[model samples]
Target: MDTRNKKRLGAMLLTGIVSLSAIASGCGNNAADDANAGANEQPANAATENAVAGAGMKDGKYDPPITITYLRPWGPDVKFKDGENQDNNVHAKWASEKLGIELKNQWISPSTNNAFETKLRLSLATNEPMPDIISYRGDFNLVRELIDSGRFVDAGELFDKYASETWKKAMDEDPSVWYPYMQDGKRIGIPILDYAYNGDPVMWIREDWMKKLGLSAPKTLDDLEKVMDAFANQDPDGNGKKDTYGLAIGFKNWINTWMSDAGWIFGAFGTMSNQWNLSADGKLEYGSVTPGAKQALATLQDWMGKGYLPTEAGLYDETKAAEDFTAGKAGIVVGPHWMPAWPLEDVKKNNKDAQYKAYPVPSGPNGQAGRHGTSNANGVVLINKDMAHPEAFFTYQNYLFDQFANPPIGGEFEYGLAEGYDWVMVDGKPTTDAAHTGGFAPEKYTITFDGARIPGLNMATLAKLADGGEAATPFEKKLKLSTPQTMLDAAKIVLEQKDITMQQLFTGAPTATMQMNNDILAKMEKDTFSQIIYGKAPIDSFDAFVEKWKASGGDQITREVNEWYQSVSGGQ
Candidate 1:
């Protein structure tokens, strides 16, 4: 990347290096005040005092606990134990007693789209004092703007100083993972990592329905079509009501999603929607504009005409579309391995005879199958420049990685995060099921913390077990105990077909042109595709849409995307 582009990309992608303010909070003896107390000293001496004040004594615990303020987005589903709230959760108590750190919430917003963003924008516009730490699962552009405002700290130095080797290794799985959180060669934001294969899309079909129809699981696109035809027309449910659909999918928004996602169908044709993929010529090209995408759209149109797809699919969102599947009115749905925990599991609740199994997406005519890949890093942790102790944050975080994520042998967290909360002793053996959580139900009512995960832990464990190995670690054991056999089987299929996973080639922020005109182009694509599938527009309308896309800002976006791709790939 060019020097200026590097800086631009850094600032655009992540937060920035920051200088701390020498301000004291409720504490009569804060590091910030301690540093300023020696103001008559030399410049070099003052610099030393400032650094010490920002970090505090690194003796594993503070004599007097220091408080760290933060903001949280509370979800509607959020619950608390009988006597426990966000301010007094098990995790908070652990931190206070073990690390001598206090957590204080500045304010919490409902965890809905635009809720936190709205509050955060107002706070930023007013130039209100930021909390000690702020974490967001999304809104990268907002974080970028905040980084530009120079209110956050450069976490690079602090991480280098305090992050344990285990934590560092977790981040090192892919060094480029840090690029999204870097600014001017400084890692300004800490990435909250997730499993790499969590987003791997799979086909979930009703096993009982397949057997009732005497159809085997599909391995090819033709076989899949045959199965869908049987499912839609043969009344596999045996309820004597022509009510079932062959497939359930939604297109109210983008085709790509975690539940009932249509990305794999496009992938079967060697393309995916809402992303850029490397073309045969080795250039990043928009997936939706490709000929393969048009062919996929045509297939979907045929499916709809044949009554293989739910009639109201266009009106449903991801989860809403799966209601038919849960109600046993649809036999097939596509989603991630975790679908068993959601709408699929609800199938058994509604109909005890419903037996669903997951399979790899059936191969296309070209003898290939594909699914969209997931980005490992999901959210970022931002710290305020005026915060007294970045090291304390690192301390708490590293402990989470080491103990909670990858606990050493004979560690306290081997069974679960907290006994009687996440797990309880049943017959003198630890169990993670909700049956044992008493009334606490820690999983549903998380009080301690949010937004941190060990990248690749769950997938790695499942892969190992799929290969005929026993759970070797506590984390693996917990996962093995909790996840269903169907999901594990699906994970094996996903792992076996890993080579077919397609990922977005461009990971940079939206270019100026894209930010300006991408929404218009997206609307055009959705409307054109939906219209064609519904028989409202000629298939040739795809060509018109393509031309319009290119004539708009798409060409500029493509050029900028290629520039970013080349920069990241060392000008390859």
Candidate 2:
């Protein structure tokens, strides 16, 4: 392989160079040495070799300055207190001073969802130059179309080549991360791995009412009934007046949808509402119209008749229902752990005597209490086909994962973005309760978007919800700020109830017909389920809905889902 060895055999073996190049393909060849011997070496990637030179890092803070063109689906009025520019925010600013990278807004507006898609498609259609990077986080239909356009590069190899160990570990934790971008043997974009259990709804109750009413914590459906009965009739507030309802459940799109869904009650009855799933026999089944749902509906109807459920529940969203519970007008509500930071916090502030606690969804018939939820599936960095610097993306991402995401020693995560921007030492302490003029925006991720102090929502906020502790940093200490007593209580219940958690992880892409007729099928399902719940139709009417659902493209959707599974699994 050396020049001297090659020269000894070269007079009649001029083809040796071709064989050596093939042998050196796996490991890197020394380009300089090869070029000195008249071997051709390309000069296009020379810029990538020097990409990290001007990047920022000093002590623990990212120094220097680097800018990125970022895009996300947000309208102009999408509120940011510390934001001055349409494109950049505190997060991007922190990335500049802390990570030495700045994010410039390439384009932003109300059209982020549809407008972004149209813009991207038109650019591709017109053969316009693409940006340095595109982080696609929109509808899957567009993602699938992007792959077909062949304008993006495969990110899988680059990830293996340059991704930091911390980021790699994150990817390794879930193989499902590769689902969206893979086509045959090619991968066009990096799958964004968001947090799990965004839909794990837990039960919250007023501990103050429990103590005042001589009531014990409910552990089963029967016990829950008794508790609800008490909340309906007994003046639990001890004012000798009946003013509260047993539960503040809402029926809006948000209530029955992912994350804030109240479908846990259906799980008790052996049904899962609003999910497309495959059962033990491998056939796709809709859980909403089954006999189990009938049982669940019966229980709900009885509660409604007993005045245990608020009449306004049919009209409330999680926010409004939470407002009712926090205002002491309802005894129970269901939500995720972050509830403590928002509506639940308002409840605690409204009444100092209002003590609340979280509990698992009560056990149902057959002694099972189940809930439906799943991890997030989007928001990763994607590469354009003509983008010159894949290494630059990896280098910047490596620092983010190593320095911000994964904490070793000398980690700045505990301090938030920086001491002066988002946090400050007031007489030598970090305080969110106090005010700092133009200091880092007091609001956490709920506030900023430009560069963002948050690495990702699922990574930062949701991770903290899981690792809440009495011993937290100025960063970690935020977990203890002003969460309502109810949300903290509900999280405890969720920890215990996690055993029955189920997610339809393999639901896959919507079928061609589903993509076209889902609106119709969804409306049918909603109308049928609503009628059954309201007694406008007998439980037997569910049979008609089932037959009609199958006829209306649901069957085709199931097969397409199966086909996608086989495709992604390589027909495993």
Query: Whose lDDT is greatest here?
Result: 1
Model 1: per-residue lDDT, tens digit, 132-214?
88876556677677777788888777776666655665666645565566666577877766555665778999999888889
Worst 10 residues of 2 by lDDT: 19-28
Q: What's the distance in Å from true for residue 205, model 1?
A: 1.2
lDDT for predicted candidate 2 compared with the true structure: 0.56
Q: Each candidate's lDDT (Cα)? A: 0.69, 0.56
What's the true lDDT of residue 18 in model 2?
17
After TM-score superposition, what is the CA distance of residue 253 in candidate 1 from its true location, in Å? 1.2
How many residue-pair clashes does candidate 2 contain? Answer: 15
Question: Candidate 2 at residue 108, lDDT?
Answer: 59
Candidate 1 displacement at residue 329 in angstroms: 1.8
Stretch of 10 with least lDDT, candidate 1: 16-25
